[model samples]
Target: MREHYRDFLIRNWEKGDRTRAAAVISYVLSEYGLGWEPNDADRDVLQVEEFYLATGGEFWVIEHQSQIVGTGAYYPINRGEKAVEIRKMYLLPSVRGIGLGKYLLQQLEAAIANRGFQQIWIETASILVEAVKLYESHGYQPETGVETARCDRVYVKYLD
Candidate 1:
């Protein structure tokens, strides 16, 4: 499938978007056996909301004809870090393999770069081969750091 690119407005997520965001998070979490069983908790949803309100992070929804097909976010790291973590990337199953994920990542990286961030980092499960490939293809490489036993891999890219 071919994906047509368009500028998705990045904005502060509203409470009403919580349900849709939860669905996206749930689908992703379950797809990778993240131990987040359905109806178990709204932890992902609450985290997203907190990320927005606490760190002033930004989220972008990949809207096709006014429907949210995917979502992603960028959040700050620390004082004078000039870096951010790409988090909660998820796309509908129908949109997978359509180049939409790549386009969304590109836009997200560009958006962060435009904000003057110099580095970007992302963590993915070992089971998520597709996501790992996407990050590697986009120049993200495995990094040595505080290893997350729960996460199989961690990647970083310097946007110099």
Candidate 2:
């Protein structure tokens, strides 16, 4: 079936969204030839509402026809830090190139800025060229360090 941008609704992650969120994330990761490790921080997203809310951050999902097609979140990198890390930002292929990723990034940036964050950080794999390009195109600058086993590219965006 065909879907339009307006058919998707972005909303806060509720208890019921855990399963679908995980599924969507897993699917996207797998599509990139990446396996979802049980210990990954994203696996804990199912229970991270308190962490996000307590840290003046939030997690959101894009739903279409009651199914989650995309997901993203941001949380303080550490206590008292003015920086937050963007996490779990992924969208199904069916919804890519239609402005959904940009929409989510814009929304996340606004939320983080409104919450007093001064910068946003993101870690991504070089294999995902499109994602890296998207971040760079949106003003995120490449940075050294902050590499993970799976994510080697680190980017930072300072908000004015």
Candidate 3:
């Protein structure tokens, strides 16, 4: 991979990041010929902190040249549950093949493990071949019985 984004910064999601996050999400889905669904609307991007941080979870954004290029988050599946659900991980085409996705996944995994979670679940579309490969490469295994109607693939990783 070439060194294209030397100034890339990965940080926790904060106030006022919703607009950029939403744009990145929209762009990625549209690029893949997908549209916003009910699940997307339910997320309420503007209240990320409330939906993630306030619920013993976290959301992060990757910024390059002061623009948000990627977004990822994990939220508790349920109160008192030892597992969390990974959601909304998206990256722009310009930064896709440079290890940023792996970096983001690693960071999110570390954060989730640090919080004492044992299992991490992720739901994604079957058409997102790169993402599936990324997760499998990092030790995420495919699992059955996913709950989301919007996504067709489910994966789980158990932290050591």
Candidate 4:
């Protein structure tokens, strides 16, 4: 289904979306001083098919004026009971504070729950202040032992 956000369209991943989505993710990471790297946790960005969709998870891309501006995605993880990890939830600075992040997150949670996932987890770096705040405000209580190399914080929320 197609979802809209103030002229932006939210849609599922397509083969053609790989490059645009990766650029969005890389841009956002570099903008935050995180500089996208081809590491363990981030390998998913380069392998969206195998990492998310092919694994039974979902990925979304948001475009405005025909330009990709943001991305959000998740994949099943082995952390908790039937758990999934939120990943690549990034938006251009121009789109921040406009509720897109919250909207994407709510959509992800709903989709995950509908798929029978029991919990959601996220790994993020403290440098991403907006992301950290968004997760906390959405009932994702902070957790310890973050395993993502570029991340120092972990948060988890139960769907049940």
Tell me each candidate's TM-score. 0.80, 0.90, 0.89, 0.95
| TM-score top scorer | 4
- Checking candidate 3 for backbone clashes, the offending pairs are none
Model 1: worst 10 consecutive residues (lDDT sum): 1-10
Worst 10 residues of 2 by lDDT: 1-10
User: What is the C-alpha lDDT profile of model 1 across 85-134, one tens digit per residue?
Assistant: 88778887767887778877887887788888988988778788889889
- The parts of candidate 3 lying over 4 Å away from their true place are 1-5, 38-44, 79-81
Between prediction 2 and prediction 3, which has the larger lDDT?
2
Total clashes in model 2, counting residue pairs 3 or more apart in sequence or in different chains: 0
Q: For each predicted model, how many residue pairs clash, with residues at least 3 apart or on different chains?
A: 0, 0, 0, 0
- Determine which window of 10 residues in candidate 3 has minimal summed lDDT: 36-45
* Model 2: residues with Cα > 4 Å off, grouped in runs: 1-5, 79-81
For every candidate in turn, the CA RMSD to the true structure comes to: 4.3, 3.6, 3.7, 1.2
- Per-residue CA lDDT of candidate 3, range 42-141, in tens? 3656678678878888888888998999988888885225989988899999998888898888878888888899899988888888999998899989
List runs of model 4 lying over 4 Å from the truth: none
Q: How well does candidate 3 score on lDDT at residue 140?
A: 88
3 or 4, which is superior by lDDT?
4
Q: What is the C-alpha lDDT of each candidate?
A: 0.71, 0.83, 0.81, 0.88
- Sort every candidate by TM-score, greatest first: 4, 2, 3, 1
Kindly report which residue pairs in candidate 1 clash with one another. none
Worst 10 residues of 4 by lDDT: 34-43
